[model samples]
Target chain A: MPIHEKSLIRPENIIRHESMNLQGVDVSGDWSTFIGSRTITDYNEDMQDEIAALPGGEYIHRCWQCGSCTNTCTVNAIEARFNPRYWIYLIRIGLEEELLRDKDILWQCVSCNKCTYTCPRDVVPEGVMKATAHWLELKGHTPDSPSTIFDREFSNQIFATGKVEEGRVLRRFFASTGQALRQPWLESMVIGLVSRLPVKMLLRLGLSAVLRPKTRKWSKSRAAITDYLQQQGRAERRALHLSAGEGTHV
Target chain B: MTHKEPTGDYNGFGPGWKATGLTPAEARRATDWVEAKIDRRALLVNKDRVEDIRERMWELEKDGEIVVHRIGDQHEPVVARTLYGWEKKIPTNSLWHHKSCGQCGNIPGYPSSILWLMNKFGIRYLDETDQTSCTAWNYHGSGIGNVVSLAAIFLRNFHQAYVSAQAQGLPVGTYYPLVHCGTSFGNYKEMRIYLMHSAELREQVRKILGKLGRLVDGKLLIPEEIVHYSEWLHVMRHRIREHQVVDCGNLRATIHPACHVYKMVPEDVIYDDTVMDGNRVAVSTGLMQTLGAQVIDYSTWYDCCGFGFRHIIGEREFTRSFAIDRKIKVAVDEARSDVMIGHDTGCITTLDKNQWIGRAVDKVYELPVMADCQFAALACGAHPYKLAQLHWHASPFETLLEKLGIDWQQAKAEFESYLKDVADGRFETLYDPKRAITSGPGFVRQQGDQAA
Candidate 1:
């Protein structure tokens, strides 16, 4: 039987003969086309277990390959290569090589939860995507994505002050991510906002930046959260078989 | 039955299979099962298979494992049905406002509009400074924060909401929380399920809550219902419509249902038969319809605003591209939408702020975006600049204001003078400024304060 979905078969895997003859009958070009068979040997047998150890990846075992996640994915709508269903299949089968092929785009999962809403098997594919992205960063298969950097900056502010000042988050994120704060669109957006000259809003933004809005009496909560996250970080590292100090850059 | 000739062509199948000798309506009726198979309503009908966390929460509370914050008569509870036909009590009065950090920081108008609406209805509420963000955006964007931390924050905020009214000589449960962010609403619901299902998570969170003095009766506090402010607007649409001073009948509006609000823990979201045939998640649409606006349907109504948590801050090009191409462009070209209304902070920010960037790529779809509460407030004659704060929005809302017959020039002038007044330390507030600080260092007990 022929491969019905030709897109699944890579171009290099298709072998077509330009000139051939079989038993005095011409069997050339399209007639003699063949699919190249390749064996995958670099399978990490513990890939599924390692992913399931993460918070969002807990339900990866429940996926029944329904493809609803990919079909309803917000990112997959624009970027065809960001397929959650395909990645989930690769992870389940321990096909690490194939999974790494699309590692860079994994962090682009928007967490829209459309897939989780549509999943009949309660797979929560959105969480699996997050876990896989985290796994990639932790295992050093990929660098920390901009998304991860932004998350760290945002989360750190909340953990510290018990509230996030948006201006602080944006400035810290952009600075940490090594991006300029003066993008054309950003400048235009600020100009547009300033054109109206809502002085109270401007003063509020300045005041919040200077005297960052915080949850009052947040010292106890901050201390508790910091301790809890440290404990979780150690546990996650243990699950991934990384050293206690490994993957601490995040 | 009258037989009609087949109009469309079919290939590969035999002529016998090509034509069913049935009318188009009959064919549609015959294949209605296919539509029903994909319908969200039908999918939710199998609710028995999916666990209702509220039942387990009640069980846990009964077993002394947790304390459920009940919505009492003081809250003026109005019961609404969820997607699975489950009952959810939405408190319309004596509410504790859970403000979104993003809204307060970015779109100040979003929460201000909500508060303005509540004030219009003379609803008793507390807009205090005690609550923290749900912190789910960072979790979703970066995956650094775990469920344990999220659950702790969830309980901590609810505990504060539970006890916030005591500063004003009221009992502990006088105020029920009305979450103002879609992200928090969804995250709290998911966290509630996690806390209920896993005793270990509850125990872990309870310890943190105890340390912060946030526990109620030495147990973690959980809200009876994680209610969104839009849900409050939805249930009060009839009464809100009664106060409509501006004619919004001529405006065509499109609602971008926040994914977190509807898609995450979808069973808890409100669905009304009167709104879009109960097909869409019916908060923004319901309010818009009740305000006498033409709620137009667009193709990409189901798409995310492309805030993407991280995408907005890190990879904003993707956010702008998706917001313009998938959402704004379609709404303008297809639906001819005058304004696009959304409920979530991120969605409004993404859709509103990103429109200006489209000019860089020549995709200039200039659709104004604002929250449903902002639109509702506008319909009720709230000042666009003073209350709704439309000037902060990056989108072209001036056209929308003109179309609504609102005088932007006069409003801008009035807002400019108001800003001068603000500069001189004289300003108007929706509620008393002293009520904002319920506890901590800056809090000074009012004359009516009583021990709880």
Candidate 2:
């Protein structure tokens, strides 16, 4: 008889013959199936340590595989493959090749923090997911995602002026992400507001767009933050065994 | 099929028959037991095992490592209980308005409603433009920023709040910070814990703050409590209800509690036994109940509004889908809510702005979304167009207004005539605009700028 829960085994690792004879008994295809030995040799042993070097990845080692994060994950409900628990397990075991399979959707973490909130062991799975996504981009596994582009656009404004004007951020983000400013839903939303908003409010919004809101005497704070982030970026690159100035834009 | 012969007690079943499977009734009981185990109240009770970071903050304060921006008698604080029954003193007066960038830029009504309500109560506040956005939205959306950057921003903004009163000839700490954005509320709380725990982090931010001259007595200034505007509305709900003119007893309201407000620092969020039996965070719900509105419950109360900082910008389809399906649809279909109330800037924007797009996919659930303060302001007889600024909202609030016995057409005409005054530069403001430029280049010293 076939082994119970045989589906758990990888189909690629299960060998089946069309027909076979076991001694005197003519055991057909059903009885001729055999389980193949499974072995892993391409483990990137430094995967866990490299991820741990990132900001959010610090507590990844604390995950005890209780699967609570995946169970309560917001993204997991929408996309079942966006599993934080499974990814953390793959990361902890140094299965870099296995992790690469889900690289595209890793950055899709909504940061709802439901995973971090429910994590029994305080693994902070949300942070781990972010670190892994960052690791992917740094190692050239993928290019900068649209989310990264938006974050950079938003953060650059704060680092420069200590405040963000939403209009400026939205326009710049759409531009950097190579998306048009004129999406159907976006146009409808703007029209809906414009139809009712007072002219003064509209003009004020227009004025803000012209002269972006900024914190006064923000030069010192901006300089300090730039210096700190650059230093942190250099340190993170070194931890990942990359040369200085690699992925500098990130 | 062959029928099994009846046995003594087993009835043809093997040993441990009870363990093999559950009957329908037994299965239901098991499901209920599991549900009860994971209920929010049970989860909150289990949270007691975690160390309270506030205890450590007090230790650090006593050790002279940090300065606590206390809620003094002047601020008139009201004590409230949190998830784990922790005491949090919410100041009811003399508040420093830490405005939200998203609210001001996206939904003008949000902050206006807040300021308008405070005016009705004659609450002392400083509506200034000196503070910066918490920048947590950027950090959470992108993996670029570290904890150090967030900590420095937190201290810088709170330091401004601490000393902002000095500009008005009042003593320092006169105005305790009242955070306007839910994201800022959550981010500041988390940053406070991080700053207290890591001496190294505090040292790093202290240097940055020192350079900016934001340090108080050469030490970082930390607030005793990070209070959200919703909490302020919650504590003052009864007083606000006394001024209520519109009867919302017929309104069915569903609250979209910001995840950042309660979930981030779950222990710090208010939970009253009177509100939803304390099973849910009580800020928005408490106010709605106090206003005599029927606060309805829905299944997806705990889900995020999909304002996933990145999801809203980069993967908008996911945001729209989640907002429409999980939030708006559930509130409309399950609760038949007249309106969806939210406390966070992003939640309001996402839920309100995304509803119009739902029609593209034939999923048109036209539910109006507004901040709790805006709704409260409307109930208290604030002009829907002038004061509450409902015109700035994307969702169709006309139906909601009509149902509440408000004349949108008259309000619109009045606002249109008011706009002519605005166009000619005759504008009305909640506070003196000169006070907005506290320390900026355009700052003009008031005549009575002397310490009282």
Candidate 3:
């Protein structure tokens, strides 16, 4: 019997989502802030080499903007505007603002690394896209991205406790991200229930959380970090003063 | 009629958590069953098992017993390493670089730090150029860009690198290789494969090249090799080891190879144990082992860092969900490692940068994430003090430093001293051309843009 097209394809593979929801989070700042800044041309030394060292740096220069990288991308299948070809073009053009404007798109990459996996030239587009996003963050524009909330709260908690206290990290993240707290009584009930779970489950979780390891205090890990930051800060300050761009007191 | 009449009292909905009358034991059993299924599925797809199976197949193929075929309709078997020999024989100089968008924000220091290290090695390189991001992120996430567009950008960059090299008195027809982010390295390799097989693509690229006079003397500008930094670093390992400019002392580290780099090119992976290695690849892991860090084995060492294309974009729940479950959760809850190290930038960002968020959502795991370099730097004593990135982390490296009884300040100073020493030639050069040439395998012939 002739196979039905529907039968030939898995029902689950059907694409049905409206797609907008899958797009990147919207940036809040004016696009103009990034447009004129020399940040686009101001590549960190070895930025090029770093890209070259990436999975497919060799073929990145081979792009002709045919959009196949985007056409074949699974992410674009879910969201139309999130085009990889356009971003590549933007980076190639040194349009720092355009790249930064789409910070959400960069983070939205699921990193299946499929584009690079599928890229004809071995461009490893995902890494390039990722590096661009990193550059944007250094410029101080955090995406209204949920992921950032977790990073910030986690860092803040770790800084305070010298170890990650999950319970504290969760509570702080909820508060910091403007997520409404679970009603006190509701939370209490949940905690009570959790406490009542099998001894093994609770024991495992509790042990893992408490045994959170700490860096040796004598290692002066903290001081080393501060010094590096200070040195980097000073260098950045000097660079800014020399370049005559707006400067911050590092 | 009697049954119907009795049912008249019942609500339309199923049991409202009361009628099933499940005992606590029953409830717990049901929960356990569900959790078991979850664990089972995770195990089956356990990234570790996947790597194991793939590695076994690789060994079989290497022994000429069987040939591995490419996935699905792709007629070609995935190309393993033809470039490794070339990379070993001739070192790369003056390359065109592409960037990764995601890592640009999260781990801002990866590229910068790598570049700084390269310069410290006295490697001649160029960073300035109008190079573009490979745009793989958007393409992978949005599916808007097509192969033709990608090839166009590929051609443009190659054209630029070739011209730059020519101007510098390098051979005019030479292929100036590119270093990349994410899957750019793999994608380029694939693109070359596609071009070799497709007359249409080759012709198209040729026409484009012709317009720009890129076909110097009607020959392709062959790039030397597409090298991943992990492999590049591995190549320099002996030298780095010999220099011994800094001491990392003692620390425990777990290495996470980028899925694109390791899983995609399983055979070519220099440290094949993890990708092809059982729980870990000895070479990559051995680098750390030799550094004197305790390496721990975990169940899900080979799982994707949740940077999978679909997970990162449309199915963030799955993306975030899996990342937490696979890497972050396993590292902290299972492996109990102090610092989770990765090879590539994207993995470093997702696994290293995303660990905190994973913990916040599920209150169990919180492991400090770092790249292999950062972790190695820690070991080499190059990173004397706890890095701010680590200090600001929930499981800061400071605690580890403290445990080691290290003077963070002195370490930091020493690390700085090493950097200066490296810059000032206080450290000896490890690459001896004569020894490398005599060892084995000279550089592979440059494969210019085959299509053009």
Q: lDDT of each model, Cα atoms only?
A: 0.86, 0.86, 0.52
Question: Model 1 misses residue B112 by how many Å?
Answer: 1.1
Residue ranges of candidate 3 with Cα displaced over 4 Å: A1-250, B1-97, B167-178, B218-224, B245-249, B271-286, B362-364, B380-395, B400-452
Off by over 4 Å in 2: A1-250, B1-48
User: TM-scores for all candidates?
Assistant: 0.60, 0.59, 0.44
lDDT score, residue A234, model 3?
54
Clashing pairs in model 2, backbone N/Cα/C closer than 3 A: none
Ranking by lDDT: 2, 1, 3
| lDDT, candidate 1, B199-288, per-residue tens | 889888878888898877888888889999999999999999999989988999998999999999998889987888888998999999
How does residue B262 of candidate 1 score in lDDT?
A: 99
Candidate 3 or 2, higher lDDT: 2
- Regarding lDDT, does 1 or 2 come out ahead? 2
lDDT of 3 at A20: 20
TM-score of 2: 0.59
| Candidate 1, chain A: TM-score against the reference | 0.84
Candidate 1 clash pair list = none
